[model samples]
Target: MAVTSAETARPLALVTGASSGIGYELARLFAQDGYDLLIAADQPAIVEAKQSLEGLGVQVTALQLDLSKVEAVDELYAAAAGRPIDALAANAGHGLGHAFLDQDWNDIMHVVNTNITGTIRLLYKVGAEMRTRGRGKILLTGSIAGLMPGSFQAVYNGTKAFVDSFSFALRNELKDTDVSVTVLMPGPVDTEFFERADMLDTSVGQSKDKSDPADVAKTGYEAMKRGDGDVVAGLKNKLQAAMAAVTPQTALAEMHRGMAEPGSGKN
Candidate 1:
């Protein structure tokens, strides 16, 4: 971990998956607000993100580590060096496209470990610390996909469902304290996610109109600051989430198939 400074009076925020997309944007918002950042991602791009954020005149510590592994999560927490983590943006996750059974076993587990296991583990560690101090903020990046039964993107959706539900449960458990937890559930966004998830051949992936990541990050960041339980990023996504509440499970799965099935973009 390369830190820009030793320590300071500024509040510290730890943001995971900060290499790019929503995570990077969230870190940028924190920097602009005078928060020092401890940012992590599995890719070398985290280093680049550090340089970019430093231009905002905030100290940034960048760690390149795969959060799916338990050791990595511990390393990230330890990097705090006993300094209080005022906020934690637990945004690290992985996505996979195609039918569940058709996907490789390793790839499937990678998504599970990254999106569910690692996220919860880090939350547990950080949440405990926050509880002890009686203060902190946590923002989780869930998805609208979690509300429905994903057809081709089964494992990814399952992981997000866990995230969305877990965040609410944890928030209620900590309500008496000043600690706050917020979940950001967004629809498709204009990011590298579609390409990385291998969903480019699907209709949802190929669509021209996707929410801007910066905008999505802003929604999440503001909701976190306000201590909201959860927020759906876009109007279209909010309507979809509202409908999922009344729609039958089988119908939701079938609808998802049309959007995420392999090569559905050509239809």
Candidate 2:
């Protein structure tokens, strides 16, 4: 999409995985705050998101791109068309369930590529430009799950661990510059995450007490605006994060097993 006449006046935010859930909520928040949006997702729902966000009176460009591939990430950056990006919410990621050995190898690789490889590559691309300009904000959607050793959801948690760690490292690297990096670590959230990961039969997946995506988005967005290094979304998650620091790795894995092991919801 061509840059609109308003693009010069309004700051732009690129939000990935924006077709639904936290990504969509983040995009909505940006629109509400007067940011033109370039939002992407791997599915057709992105088209619907653009239509909905346009109601807020901002130029919304939607792309359906699989961020798991290197080429797709490049295409997304090119879509910016050399326009300055004021903020980037690299929130595109998904999970996989079941034992690592039991899960399909392709699915595992896809999860890693989406959650870690693509995320890091996009950050590198946009973050460099932001550093050169000396101003920008970046928010990465990490997970409280990263704090623990996931038994049934090992690969997904491992990827988030990388995100949670990488965000802080990058933030420090840019400390001398105006570019800000913040990681949003949220616990179980009410989204299609469980269903998509085929974890609906797990305890955490079936629980009704998941954090609302809007609230999570707000927590992350506000922290990004403030240039905070990190923000864990909810009180429960905050407590969990605090405890995880002291929790034994074996115990944490056991806890995850109780919540994520297939059919644990039936207990």
Point to the candidate with the largest lDDT: 2
lDDT by residue (tens digit), candidate 1, 1-267? 633346588999999999999999999999999999999999899989999999999889999999989999999988888888899999999889999989999999889999998999999999999999989999999999999999999999999999999999999999999999999999999989989999999999999989999999999999999999999999999999999999999999999999999999999
**Model 2, range 1-267, lDDT digits (tens) per residue?**
745544368999999999999999999999999999999999899999999999999999999999999999999999888899999999999899999999999999999999999999999999999999999999999999889999999999999999999999999999999999999999999999999999999999999999999999999999999999999999999999999999899999999999999999999
Clashes of each: 0, 0
lDDT of each: 0.94, 0.96
Best by TM-score: 2
The runs of at least 3 residues in candidate 2 whose Cα sits more than 4 Å from the true structure, single-residue gaps closed, are: 2-7
lDDT of 1 at 110: 88
Error of 2 at 180 (Å): 0.5
* Pairs in steric clash, model 1: none
